[model samples]
Structures are given as C-alpha cells and as structure tokens.
Target: MNTHMEAYYQKRSDIYNHVRNASTYEKIAYSFLMACFTGIAAQIVIPLSWTPVPITLQSFAVMTAGIVLGRKYGVLSMILYCLLGLVIPWYSGMTGGLSVLMGATGGYFLGFIICAYFVGSISDKFPKSRKFIGMTGTLLIANFAAIYIPGLATLYLTMSSQGVSLSLSQLLMMGLVPFIFGDILKVLASSTFSKLVMPKEE
Candidate 1:
C-alpha cells in the first residue's frame, strides 16, 4: 500500500512539475481554458427551496481553479469569466449584461476573482497531498467571506432600493445557511478531484 501510494504521488508530482515548467503562453492558455470550463460550471444551476441564491457548480470550479492554476492565473481567468458574463448571459439563472453584473448579485460574481486568488493562494501553501486537500477544505470556510460579504451587503442595498426589508438574519437564513451543506460537499469533492488530477502546486 505504501509503495503504491508513493508511486501515485510521485507520478502526480512529476506531471505537476512538467506543467509548471511549460512556457508561460502554454500555462496562460490552459488557465484560460479552465476559466471557460468554470464558466460552464456556473451555468449548472439548481434553484433552492428557500433562497434566491441557487446552488451552482460555480464554487466547485472556482475553488478548484485556484488550487490547480495558482493565484495569478486563477485570478486572471476568473476576471475573464466575469467580463464574459457581461455579454454572454451566463450569470446565475442564465442572466447577463453589464446591468445584470452591476446589480444585486454582481458581488457574488465579482467575488469569484477574489475567491480564486485567495483560496488558490492559501491552498498552495501546503506541500503534501494530504495537507493540500485538508488545508484547502478547511480554508473554504474562510473563503466564503470572499463570496458573502459583497453578496450579502449588495443584496441588502438592492432590497433597500426597492423598499424591501431584508434583515441580516433573513439574509443569513436565505443565502448562507442553506448553502452550507452543499458548499461543503463542493469543497470536499474539489479537493478529492485535485488529489487525483493534479499536484499540490500549479
């Protein structure tokens, strides 16, 4: 078991090293491709029973991009994702437009840039496979701040603009609480996929 485990990690590490040593253009191209994939992941949506926020594969893709692409490329790709969202109608619920982006949920979409950077940055801190997966999963909670702070704050402001009363507790119940289990599942799945697909570092 130990020998096979060592061989598995060795092969994963070697592939990672080769990818890392590739030309900058190649790396950027790969990251851009991953970014596009993440955008598609965003469109895989499941509306929730209680909240306006749907459960999408976005967080999974966003988080995984960071870990796989590293901070600089991860963030770059997400920014591209955001710009593309403006015209492509690929935002949540198949919505788009700069107007849609600047509206209530823009924060969440914008947050993906920060999310990829922050989560990818921290996940890169670990060296071993076990540490990488565990640390990334643990860091997912902290990374939620990247998503929620802007999302909830803007949501409240948007509600106020329409003379709707959306309290903090209500926001938590609707936006945060319900997504906890699903997000955890995403984190775990992404981390596990990382273990099989790539090395700890980009």
Candidate 2:
C-alpha cells in the first residue's frame, strides 16, 4: 500500500513538474487562462448595501493562481487580469475601465496582484506550504497583508475624496469586518483545492 501510494504521488509530482517547467508559450497560455478564470470569478459578486466592495470569488481565484502557478506566472496572471479588465466589463458588477480601477474597490485589484505574488513566493520557497495547514496560514497572512491593508486604505481615501467622512472604525466595519467570514471560507477552499491539485514534493 505504501509503495502504491508513493508511486501515485510520484506520478503526480511528474505532472506538476511538467506544467511548472512548460514552455514560455504554454506558460503564457496558462496565465491568460487564469486571468480569464479571475474574470469569471469576479462576476460571482454579492453586493453589500453599505460597502462599495462586493464579495466575490476573486480572492479564491487569485490565491489558487498563486499556489498553482507559483510566484512568476502567478503575478503574470494577475497583471493580465487587471490590464484586460480595464477594457473588458469583467470586474465586479460587470463594470470595467480606468474608472473602476480608480474607484473604492480599486485597491483590492492591486491587492490581487500583490496577494498572488506573496502567496506564490511563499509556496515556491517553502515546499511545506503546499500542504493544507501551511497553505491556509499563508493564505490568511496574505489576505491581511496583501489584500485588506491596501483595500481599506484605498477605500478610505476614495470615500474621503468623495466627501464621505467615515471613521476608521466605520471603514473597518464596511471594508473588513463584513468580509471576514467569507474570506475565511475562501482561504479554506483555496488551500484545500490547492492541496488536492498540487502534488507533494518527491
């Protein structure tokens, strides 16, 4: 049984290595596909009455891209997503253009890129991060550092510029608190999905 399991893992490892070391064209294609996946996920939005930020599957897609594609290609995927989104109505609420990127939720778009790179870097540098617990921890940290910080900052600045005076507590309530539960769920899901699809290092 042990030998069989080892063989199975070895096969998976080989497949993963093949994809990781794929040709430049193949990597570009994969990055483009991930960008498209993010666009699709952005459409799965649950809007909040108070906050401009919507709950979307974008974080899941971003984290998954990082875990699966590693640091380099993961960043590429997010860059492609952001750039293409400027012209395509693929952002949340099916809205697009520079205005959307300059809006309250714009920081999250930047966060997506940074989050992907941060998660991907950790996943690549620490092989253990491919495991469930490690991946989940990494995702959680990335969410706070790479996602929420910039997200909240941009939200505050944008709202302030529009003459909306909100306290820091209120900003947290709108931009951070409401999304905590859902973000936790997304972290778990992203970790699980990543572990299932990513092979254990031989």
Candidate 3:
C-alpha cells in the first residue's frame, strides 16, 4: 500500500513538473483561453429577484483554470479576465465596466483572482490534490476562503454605501446561503473536470 501511494505521488509530481515547465507561449495561450472560458461561463447566469448576486458558472471556470493552469498562469488568466472585462460587456447580464467592478458582485470578481491563485497553489504544492477527493476538498475551502468571504464583505460595503445596512445573517442570506448548494455542485464539477484535464504521468 505504501509503495502504491509513493508511485501515485510520483506520477502526480511528474504531471505537476510538466505544467510548471511548460513553454512561455504555451502558458500564455492557456491563460488566455481560460480567460475566455471564464467570460463564456459568466454568460450562463441565473438572476434572482431578491439578491443582486446572480448564480453563474464563473466560479467553476475559475477553479478549473487554477487546477489546470497552476498558480502563476491561473492568476494571469483571472487578471486578464478582470481587466478586459472593464472594456467588454462580458460580465453577467452582458454588463461590464469599472462600475461593475464596484458593484455588489465586485468582490466576487476580485475573489476569482484570489480563488484561482489559492486553488492553483494548493494543486501545485500537493500532488495528491490532483485526485478527485483532494481536489474537491481544496476547492471547497477555496470557495469559502477565497470567494465567499470577499464576496460577502463587498456586498455589505456596497449595500452600506447605498444606505442599506444589513446584519451579518442578512448578508449571508444574500451572498452566501443561497449559493452554498450551487457552489458545492460547482466544486464537484470543477474537480471532476480538473481530474480529466490535469496532466497524467506517462
């Protein structure tokens, strides 16, 4: 059993090395592609009447980018997505601009960058995380630490700026509670996809 575990870890390490040592052009290409994927995912939105935060596959795409691209390029992809979003109407509801970045969901947008980095770093550091269980666990933590925290804080601040003060429970209802089940599904999907796309040792 120990020998099998060692061999599995070695295989995962080989895959990580391949991704880490990818050519600059390849890295850039993958990052740009992920940025585009995130934009496309953002278009699949389910707007709710009660909350400004819409349900979208953006988080899944972001998590996938991290797992597939590793930390450096994953962060690059998110940065590209966010920066270009300011000039293109690719955000949710076909909206974009600086205003979008300052709106209720702005923190979630920022959280994407942080999420990508956090997930990528973990995947890169822990070769075992390439497996489904590990990847799912990592993404779950990343969702709350890197996404929901910033999202809820931003929601609170944005609402306060508009003279709409809400309690912590209320904030959670708007930004966290409604999305828990969906986010779990997203994490599972992202992990499954990552297991497929992440390199395997030859």
Candidate 4:
C-alpha cells in the first residue's frame, strides 16, 4: 500500500510537470491575448457619476479570467494587459501610457488584477461548493479590498491635487456610491460565468 501510494504521488507529479511544460507557451499566449482583450474592452465607455472613468464591464472580464485561469495565469493576464496598455498606443483610450496608470480610473484597472487572483484563489481552495456562494464571497472580498480602497485613495489624491475639497459624505457619494449597483451586477454576472465554465475537480 505504501509503495502504491508513493507511485501514485510520483505519477501525479510527473504528469503535472509534463502538462506544465507542454502548455507553457499556450498559457503565455492566452494570458497576453486576454490582456489585450481587456484593454480593448476598457476603451468602451460606460460613463458613471463618480468620474470620467465609466463603469465598464472590463472588471467583470478580469474577474472571470482569474476564476477561470487560476492565480498565476490570472495575474499574468492582468500584468500583460497593463503592460500592453503602457506599451501599445492603440490599446489605450482617449488617454494612453503610464498616464492612464496615474488617472482616477487606474485603481479599478489595478484592482482587476488583484480581484482576479483573489477570486481564483478562493474558488480553487473551495471546490465542490455552490458556485454562487464561492464566486460571490470571493468577488465581494476581492473587489472591496482591491477596488474600493485604492479607488478612494486615488480619488482623494486627485481631489486634493485639484484643490476640490469635499466632506467624507460627499466623497463617498461621488467616488463609491454611484458604482455599487453596477459593480454588484458585474459580480453576479461574472460569478455565474466563472462557476459554469470552471473545470470540475477530479
């Protein structure tokens, strides 16, 4: 029994390595393609009350990518997308380059990467659970951390720089309040898709 168990473990390891090696290039390519797709999606405007950065569905795409691709690939796709936005001029929108990184909307873009990893990690950890529960919880936690915090910070800084003084209540209304419903919808839609398309456990 001990020998059989050892052999089983070894075989699994070997298979994992073989699969990794075989799919490395394809994974890389897909990650990059997804990133590009993300950038293009971002360019499509969905203007919101918060700022010029409209409430785009690209965040949903990023979240879904993470749940589907797992951690490393999800993060890779996000990084690739950001790098492409920095490098490829045509990939960006009305503004381009690292400038976008500094913009008010940048936090959400950055959040997309973090959100993906968070959602992916949680889903991967808790397989065999109901899809909505896993996806919703992960997404809520991730987006709250990755989007709200940084978004507020960016808004504060931008406001301060612009000398636009506003109370916390006003700030919340302007920065966070407008997008909650849209974000929730995005989370629900993305969670559903991720749960459906994700692979079943062995």
Candidate 5:
C-alpha cells in the first residue's frame, strides 16, 4: 500500500508541481528545461562485453537532480527526461518513443529516476553523519534502489521475451553480478561529489 501510493505520487507529482508552483513563467521554464537537460546528460553508454545494457551515466544525473532540486523537482526532472526519451531521440544511442520504453533496457532507465529520488531525499534530509558510514549507506541504498532492481528486471524480462531459459544464478551472473563493483564505485563517487557540492549542513 505504501509502495502503491509512492508510485502513484511519483507518476503524477509533476502535474501537481505545474499547477501549484508556476508562479513565474521563468521558474516554470527553468524547472522543465533543467529536467530535460539533465535527462539528456544522463543518457550515457558504457561499452562492455557480454552485458545487455551498456552502463550509462543516467543514474548520476538522476541523483544529482534529486539532490539539487529536492524530491518533487528532481522526480519531475526525471519524469520530463523520460517523457522526452519516449517522444524524441534523446536517450542513450539517441533513441526514444514507445519502442524504446518497451525495449530491454527500459526498466533500468526508469529505475534511474526512482533511485535519484530515494538517494536525494535521504541525503538532503539527513546530511549529518559520520563521513564513512552515512555517506556509504546513502550511496549504497541509492544505487541498490535506483540501479540494481530495474537493471536486473529489464534483463530478466528481455531475456524471457527472447525465449531464453534464465536460471536465478544465470540471471544474477548476467545482470547483477557483473555490475556490483562498478555500481559501488559510482556510489562512492556520487556520495563524495554530492557532499562537496551540497553539504548536508546547508
């Protein structure tokens, strides 16, 4: 029930923002525009062997958006970003639309936004903590939520659609196992950078 409400709000919060917060035309434009820009910036492709989805930096921007814009705007930015990728060729590989949304990597792509919200909201709200534990926890949780779930789910669905019999182990091998290290690195990097730019105290 909680998850359902979050999903419901996550889907439509952008509309709410537009209705209540459009006090100035410039604010409205900037918010929407920044959302699109960050979305495009996040569509990065990582070249690798035997991996279905190229590691993209979309999550980084998603995280940054949340930290900078706060929960509502950060999610809105991601929402706009996703919409653009769906309607225009602005995502990784310059791809977009329903086809892309229905594509194998789409789930992870969507996951980026969710992760950003979780990571950003937590870090922004609770900035004070021991450097090692809080930061690491922040990064770890964010990455797990934002990246791992969606990435693995996408791989599972895509492979299943292709009529491939993917065992739990095989699925982990292809989807989760390979990216753990890299995601850890991203978490560390994002945490460090976030701390520097937007210190919790402010």
Candidate 6:
C-alpha cells in the first residue's frame, strides 16, 4: 500500500493511482473466471470400458489453468473450483459434492491442485524457454505425475476395495495409457498460449 499520494493537479497522477488496485482485482477476477471455465469443461464427459472412470475435459482445463495463471493464482483458481463444486454441479456427469471429491476419481481432482502448483512453478522458472518447450515439458511431466500416479493409485485402491482384480498391464492400459495423447495436446496448447500472452521479463 502506498503511504501517501501527492496530488499532481495538472498531470492527473491521482486518477492513475487506482490502477494498482484495479490490476490486483482484475487478477483475482480472472482466477475466478478460469475456475468457472474449467468447471464448465468438466461437464463434457465420455464413458469408456467397464470402469466407472470416464474421460473428461477437466485435465485439459487444469493444464491451461496452471500455464495461464502461474503458481499462486493457479492454485487459488483450482481451490475455488473445488469449493464451487458444492453448488455448481461441475464434475463429470454433472455431479458434485464432498462425496465426489472423496470418491473413486477423487484423486484426479485432488491432483489438480498439486499439478497446477508445480506446473506453474516450472513455467515461472523458465518463462522464456525456447519456443516454450520447457513449459510444455513442465506441463506434461506435471500432468503425468499428478494424474497417472495419484489417479491410478486411487483407482487401484477403489477397485481393490470392491474386490476387482487386474494385472499391472491392465491397470496401465485402462488408466494411464488412454490419456497420454490428450494430455500431450493439452500441454502443447497451454504452453503456446501462455507464451503468447505472458509479458516478457525485464
């Protein structure tokens, strides 16, 4: 906060002083907007195989959210998204609640937080990487770790608790392999857009 603002009657610096607050507000507002957009993306779900887990746009939005918002804002946006699930019904098949966040696919939702944080951190660290390849790598690795590890673990636990049996290959085929191509695409798009919009460092 500024301690004091001198009035420059002729130059009109007083009128421009509010820009700082407006910029801050604009950032927070954009975070909420990203939250809502990601929530909407989650609504388009496609079921596959006998498993309960289905492909959704949630991951794509998560990649974009992290790349675009950076660490602090990205995490804030996703947490807002998690909370908004209470009343917005933004999860797959239009479902939402504390229950869903703790359900079989809850790992994906929870992983979004970790993914966004690390991905954004990587982007910040290498903001000007050549053609943004570093950003793409960051996003891809984050997604892989976030979704594949936690997601498969949760799915395994959920299935095991329900007395289901599957080989390791089966688990990889069913849970991890299917999403690689999609995640790569999301990473590319996220990196490109983030690079385009991000301001150059001084």
Clashes of 6: 0
Pick by lDDT: 2 or 6, better one: 2
Residue pairs of candidate 5 with colliding backbone atoms = 86-97
lDDT of 3 at 39: 94
Clashes of each: 0, 0, 0, 0, 1, 0
> TM-scores for all candidates?
0.86, 0.95, 0.88, 0.80, 0.75, 0.81
Q: What stretches of model 3 exceed 4 Å from their correct place?
A: 1-20, 199-202
Best candidate per lDDT, number? 2
**lDDT digits (tens) for residues 58-164 of candidate 4:** 77778867775667887899988777777675233545688777776667667777877876677666664326777787787777787778777787777778888
TM-score winner among the candidates? Answer: 2
Pairs with backbone N, CA or C atoms under 3 Å apart (clashes), candidate 4: none
- Per the 3 Å backbone cut-off, how many clashing residue pairs does candidate 2 have? 0
lDDT tens digits, residues 69-144, model 3? 8899999999999999999888987889999988999999889999999998988778668778889999999998
In candidate 1, what residue range of length 10 has the lowest lDDT sum?
127-136
Q: Rank the candidates by lDDT, best first.
A: 2, 3, 1, 6, 4, 5
**Rank list by TM-score:** 2, 3, 1, 6, 4, 5
Residues 1-202, candidate 2: write the lDDT tens digits. 9999888778778877987999999999999999999999999999999888998889999999998888999999999999998999999879899999989988998999999999989988888778999899999999878999999999999999999999989999989998899999999999898777777563
| TM value for model 6 | 0.81
RMSD to true structure for each model, in Å: 2.5, 1.3, 3.9, 6.8, 10.2, 8.0
Error of 1 at 195 (Å): 3.5
Among residues 3 or more apart in sequence or in different chains, the pairs in candidate 3 whose N, CA or C atoms overlap within 3 Å are none
Q: Of models 4 and 6, which has the larger TM-score?
A: 6
Runs with alpha carbons beyond 4 Å of true place in candidate 2? 1-4
Q: For residue 45, what is the lDDT in candidate 5? A: 72
